[model samples]
Target: MTDDDPDRDIRCQDALQAAYRELVSAAIMAGWSEREVVLAIGELADKHLLSLETNDNADALIALLRRMT
Candidate 1:
């Protein structure tokens, strides 16, 4: 992956995720089920990867949080 490569953005993202795999493990260690961890990671899609309807994702997060209580 290089600056000129169109897939560089996503390539670097994968590399970063590999480096952060421990963080994901830590979330699971903290008692978060795998499904909850996946949902939390999916939330980051709106924040970083796909920026469409950001607020809608946020609203859904809030709703999920409310349901947890």
Candidate 2:
């Protein structure tokens, strides 16, 4: 499939979700609390966001994070 194929986006999203679930499950099995796992994900997101240049997408991400609280 070409990069422009919309189906690719959906497939990628599905794959990402599966990987996320597996990682979270592994972390929990490793004795990390649910809250710890969530906090760790938030920290990772924060670090990635800091590297992004300011733009509407960044603003939207920040807003979404705020809404989660």
Candidate 3:
């Protein structure tokens, strides 16, 4: 898979953290309460995972699923 593909499982801990930070910033700017912001971020992550093709990164997806449990 190309390095840019999210399902390629490229090391993305830093990128994910940065993205979460940006989400928090956007939530605050939109006047969302902290709880609402957290829930929104969770939904965003779920949606992102839902968009990926299953065969593109089984290992990475399994690890992520493990963490969710």
Leading candidate by lDDT: 2
lDDT of 2 by residue, 1-69 (tens): 799997998988787998888888899999999889989988998978766756667899999999999
Q: Which residue pairs of candidate 2 clash?
A: none
Residue 41 error for model 1, in Å?
1.6
Per-residue error (Å), model 2, residue 26: 0.7
TM-score between candidate 2 and the true structure: 0.54
Reference-based lDDT, each prediction? 0.83, 0.87, 0.79
Task: Report the CA-based lDDT of candidate 2 relative to the real structure.
Answer: 0.87
Give me the runs in candidate 3 sitting further than 4 Å from their true place.
Answer: 1-11, 53-69
The candidate that wins on TM-score is 2
Better of 2 and 3 by lDDT: 2
- Residues 1-69, candidate 1, lDDT per residue (tens digit)? 467999998888888987568877999999999788888888886577556677679989999999999
lDDT of 3 by residue, 1-64 (tens): 4787876554566557888788788888989988899997788878888767565588788889
Candidate 2: where is the Cα deviation over 4 Å?
A: 1-12, 54-69
lDDT-better candidate, 1 vs 3: 1
**Residue 19 Cα positional deviation in candidate 2, in Å, after optimal superposition:** 0.3
lDDT of 1 at 49: 56
* Candidates' RMSD to native: 11.8, 10.6, 10.9
